[model samples]
Target: MFSRAIAFIAAIGIVLTVNKPVISQNHSEHHSVPSPSETSAERESSRLTESHVNEGLTKLHQKNYSGAIESFGKAVEIQPSHYLAFTYRADIHRLLKNYQAAIDDYTKAIEFNPAHSYLRNSRGVSYAALGDYQNAIEDYTQAISIYPEEGAGYRHRGAAYYQLGENEKAMADLNSAISRNQKDAEAYTIRGEIYTNLKNPDLAIADYQQAAKLFLTQSNREGYTKAINLAKSLQQQSIVPDSK
Candidate 1:
């Protein structure tokens, strides 16, 4: 489905950061607390959850997505308020095409850490996949506002604009992304598509050419084919102007 900007999607699509929760202890409270054994169990649970989170990171490195998901899920079960666990688990759900489940986990994570802009960006991607472009734009806009220097935020937002048939907005955002990140072949490719639709064959050819070169450099066979094929077609069309 996303055969065009595979690398681009991988860049801005996932939330992998683990947040360390702060637990403040109150020594002034005279009320009763948990028993010593109960405290031990709580400590054990926290330790085990940390272990699970570590194992999940290892599984992700090994490309065992399902195993990673299981580990993160276990961490969430051990501590439902574990924001990182929920965020990681939500990413797995998103990769597995479980959009609603991913949204739920992301929502829970956002509740725990509302200041993170990328969380909104990641959740926005899921919303876009489910044909919720409006929500995706909202999240992307928030992300842009939060981190104006982030090029990927603009890239994804441009794609969403293109999907919504807002070529002008899409092109503008893609231009911003490309100007900031020269190596962003995905942004070039997407902007090329926008140019093609806007009847700017010369600009499309330029973008597609750059996209193909970048994809080849990245060793992405699918992106190479997509860009090269479109570029060639556009080149041919440009060779023959329409008769007035």
Candidate 2:
């Protein structure tokens, strides 16, 4: 989820992040979710808007990030309240390292679709990247309150807590992340790092081992190797502490 949050819209860069899953707007529900279908026409106008979106996606796939943004911009301009275009454009901005712009577009997207937790989390991740952990924590807390079943929110909040050196709170949040999703490899990995910071190599190694196994199960070989290597390195450090 961090990768989803942090990884560019298409794996374009490396940094801290959360997952950015597409927000699912429930059309069948009676709730106040805004539907673009309501605003857009079925024949000519809808075709044009959809064409722009498709072109944007194609540009994104071609690694034409700026062009993709422009196309999404056109889509939104056609339907000023197009939620998907705003979200996609925001993602491109985030991937392009335009954090503030991404935040702005994410905000607009949220305006059009308020109940989507991933959108909130995506904005929080950008806020965190900009060194605004308090705001990020607020966003994460709100998302978690809205969707308690989601582990990504907990993982993000835990990481933000760790950033503020609130190790106890971070551990509690990390535990929640694991409880919500037993296969949360990043939570285990991060908790292991926290245990390392606490100077408890035994617990650290255990967590790292779990993360490695989970990553392997998730077919994330790179993550598995990194966690395993970290565990091995920690074991060596445990065997030979630094001279005081």
Candidate 3:
């Protein structure tokens, strides 16, 4: 169920905004004008890469996943340093359950854009999907190091810790996540599971109730239904007479 909760979030695919590719001017070329032919080739490559990225986005929007991957692949082939192309391709691979392919693409993306915490998080998700919690935790840790103020990394790491049966570490990370963002429905849901495992039904039910409220607010009907049902189930159990 915790895996389902995480999967729900991942199901909402990440759509990276596209921008016109800008050709980076080389410092060495500043002193002397490039040959006209070289300049034309560079500009042409940029234009083609931009066109491919835009086409990829359109295909992605239309749910033409294979076409989207092809287009993104072309973009990256034209410009190997295009991190956005790598990222989009990685997302598609992840959705397709090609976890290893997704990790490979995400690694390429991270190489070109190391400062992006979301890239690390995305890679971690793929790693987690493969049941590699240790690698997932490492990626989440990097994401947290890059953006300590954000709650996503903490929430992700908490889930990974939970999977590894490190409940105390999970609790700490989940607490940090909730402290940073009280509206994080997934964090509350996960924390509720931890409470249930600890035999603290009162706290667990309370967390589930809160998660239901937040999930409703976020228009996550599935999550809201799950949380509310969990809360009600716990409530019913609490009132049940003990078997002598």
State residue 82's C-alpha deviation in candidate 3, in Å.
0.6
User: Which candidate number has the best TM-score?
Assistant: 3
TM-score of each model, in listed order? 0.79, 0.81, 0.85
Q: Across residues 1-244, which tens digit of lDDT does each residue of candidate 2 receive?
A: 2122222343554223343366233212322344566653544565677678768767776779889899989888887778878887887787777899989998999899887777878888889989999999998998887788888999999999999999999999999999988888999999999999999999999999999999999788999999999999998877796799
lDDT of 2 at 184: 88
Order the candidates by lDDT, highest first: 3, 2, 1
After superposition, the stretches of candidate 2 with alpha carbons farther than 4 Å from their true spots are: 1-20, 23-43, 241-244
Worst 10 residues of 3 by lDDT: 16-25
> Which clashing pairs does model 1 show?
none
How much lDDT does each candidate structure score?
Answer: 0.76, 0.80, 0.81
Q: Candidate 3 lDDT (Cα, whole model)?
A: 0.81
What is candidate 1's CA lDDT for residue 232?
98
Candidate 1: list runs displaced more than 4 Å.
1-41, 241-244
Q: How many backbone clashes does candidate 1 have?
A: 0
